[model samples]
Target chain A: MSDDVAKFLDADIPDPTDFPADAPGLRQLDEALRCTMCRELFEAPVTVNCPHGHCFCSMCIRTALATKDECPLCRHAIREVHLRRNTAVEDAVRAWGLARTFVLQVLREKEEAKAATVASKYFSGKPKSKKRRRTPELSSDDEVVEVGERNVSHSLKGHTSSSSSGVVPCPICNKSVPMQNINNHIDQGCPSPKDADLDVLLSPSSKSKGKQKQEWSKLFQGGGAGSATTGSKKGKGKSRGADQDADPLPKIAYDTVTQKRLREILEELDLPTTGDRATMSARHSRWVNMFNANLDASPSQRKSVKQLMLELRRWEEAEEKKKTRAKLDAKDFDSGQYQKDNKTTFARLVEAAKPKAPKKSQSPHEGPPASSLSPSDGDSIAPPRRTEVVTIED
Target chain B: MFEAGPVSEADFFTWEALIMGPKDTPFEGGVFAARLTFPADYPLSPFKMKFDPPLFHPNVYADGTVCISILHTPGDDPTMYEAASERWSPVQSVEKVLLSVISMLAEPNLESGANIDCCKLYRDNKAEYERIVREGIKAQLGL
Candidate 1:
């Protein structure tokens, strides 16, 4: 069964060795060779050297590193040492030539199956995203508010992929998810092994005892990593007058409630409310002059304005992080990934290039069918000169 | 970034590499020392690696920097044969590149290389090139 499925995927992939012959245990190494965002073979794959697989594409990984050198997928510490190519894998590849053809047929078959499944669903009337499937879980359809602004109509269609049937039970752990989701699992997306009631990934001592050790360390000024990041700035960091200098334009209609709200917002960051008492008194005196400007808007509008600012800040930070990760992956992703193996060709190459016949000859049961389009171009790849076009793989 | 190379007599800008005759290939048991001169923009630009005792092969450059697709810099090349990924980039290190070079010596991608004379000699005039390669390997190995 494993051979069949492996053969299927390999049938098309140009470089068969790129996929782990034994997947489960080497998931991290496998994931490291691929791009996280693209969910395919990397154009320039980069590895995050974590004991637990926390791999991401180089470009994504590098962008994330700008904030900190942590793997984008699982936040593991990334060291330069992890950047070395898997030489054993490379040697196997140098020997393998190009990928096979049968793997492509299975992939194509899988695609057809998925297209068939999507067409049968009730939501197919309108083209909707997979996220919209099984809408609202509401019995009364009219009550459920559709997601979107006034102009756009929305539809929900849940989708299952084509490679659904008889996927090889993952060789590593007996457990198997779709092959497409393997990298995610390896890179933090995989349910924590500790999450399984059956297996304890880390012994209980490692978790609780480690936490206690951290707390003791924090007391000694070793502080948490976040604090350490702001390290060596004990004297020169924040200004001494920082607390007293905040909310300078105070008493502008500084009603008790408004003052409380402002205090609540500012206090989140432990900022100051006012300067000297004289400064406070001056602001209060000016309250008579400026109260209307502060209070003109309705309370909800003011609250909403604050919320909007907070939300915007959150989005901006997230965007910044996203861009950082993207840059990292771009910079590092696909560094060694050869360009010939896009998923389609990768699957095809794998199929075409399988070891002529694995030990036990099967009943020849018409293994898998060929692609409908008929690769009239034939099996040869664009000769070695054209070998450098990097393709993202799954 | 600068560490003394493994072999003595090897310089940083131009290091000496002992290319072991790949086992079972036509150039077997032959020890070939080559000169690898990295450009100022090396890792970005392809490094020039040439046999000290020059010999004939299809993919080798006239000056002896490897002309394999993997060694081409991923920049605008006047020739359209190589893709950006196939070209050399700063990310590539000496180890990976040497691996590719070794592969090229064994494989000799003849399609793109226009060294028709050397290629013809290699394919049709096999006995001659082999003898030359074998003798060059002898000089490089000091054997």
Candidate 2:
């Protein structure tokens, strides 16, 4: 018996290359595997007596179901004693695996042969030179790249000089122009190269939210800065430098409303917040980063992403609050619109807004029954009391 | 020693009897049989039993009778009815009753007997008592 098992394990497999490229049997196995409920490789398999030859895991067929039951795949009723393991099916599986390995090996050999043919043509060829090569002799990287339809002279035909300030590389035509022209290149793939510097001053003054404009003048006038980097503080007044008056608000300020939104975003994202001073600065910075990412989107796309974000924020708030039952305000009811329904009023403009609860329509299928809430049934409303006395010594 | 027996369980249960007459006893050279018809509540109550041929032994009754120990109803013999050993118990089987009868034939305890006249006859007139018992055995055997 041991010898027989060893023989079975070492059973010779035929080369799968011998089968045609479109072998029907391989296709059948793929189709069969797709149909298998476990969607895994077959194990101790059994075939019921049904004519279609549907197979199943033998143990599943035997124990996962009832005694003397029908075959699941074919619906053919069978006796418990009649179910038999199909050793022949296992032999087919082994043969299939061997065939697949042999076929893959054959394909690998074919690919190697093709690679050798391509190598011989490239490595065995001689290089071209300026004199020995004929006029039309081929094989030049520069000429081939140019011939790949760069048409560089024609590409620069209708344009001259960069208009924008900082140098921006044009992706196509391999040209470096300027930043303001990037939108032009992206829009029409051609940038007018002029008017570059006037639109490109560092406008810390123009962005003057509060005292920022005066602070810039002090920066130019040379203030408390260590060096006389500014021209001179020579004739400045008793009042401190304008830079001192500056609040140093960052270029992007998260206003109270946006800051509140930012905290909701961070909390929704479940980022860990440290209670110590060391991370308090980082937690504040993270709020700005998440806020700008939502706010500074292109104006058209901005509304939807922000809306989705806030609605998702609301859902997350609802989810986190789910563990505790909602407390109804003892004095407060939803006078319903006064209950912050306006924040959601803009939401309906976007199609994905949460639908408001429809006004309570008293369909017969719904609402309080007519039998109830009537004055005659008022006395009947309260449940009867034949209270059973329950007591415990403990 | 007496011991309990198997429950008599069947549609209609019967007891198998095999009694022996002891030697040198007044009722020797004879084997007798008696059927004890017990009610369902046998040990809680009494049974009606009698011998085929009545004898004139000290423990036997005035009629055709075999009076032995281990056959009285349950509880103290309130009438001071019979010797304590003669009353029945749940543990007493047919075999134990047959053995008791054999022992009674050898040496009868007449002090606590039901038939007072037979007890007196055995003590006063042993020859006459033996003769009448022998005659009863003969009639039973039809010899």
Highest TM-score, which number? 1
Give the CA lDDT, 0 to 100, for residue A114 in model 1.
43
Q: Please compute DockQ, using alpha carbons, for every candidate against the native two-chain complex.
A: 0.04, 0.00
Worst 10 residues of 2 chain A by lDDT: A385-394
Question: What's the true lDDT of residue A334 in model 1?
Answer: 72
The fnat scores of all predictions, in order, read 0.00, 0.00
- Per-residue accuracy of model 1 over A1-394 as CA lDDT, tens digit each: 3444344435443333434455443344444444444333443333458766544433334333433454434445675435433333432222221121223333344444444444534456544344454653442132222222111211111122445443432322224656566445433312423223321221233343444233322322222442355454331112213312223233223344455555443333222234433333332333311222212222211111222222222333333333454554464667445454466777877888787757886653221123311222122111111111111000
Interface Cα root-mean-square deviation for all models? 21.6, 41.2
- Summarize candidate 2's per-residue lDDT along A257-345 as a digit string, tens digits: 35445544434333223233333333444333333332222221122222222323333233223222222322354656564666665
Flag regions of model 2 displaced more than 4 Å: A1-394, B1-18, B43-48, B62-65, B81-86
Docking class of 2: incorrect
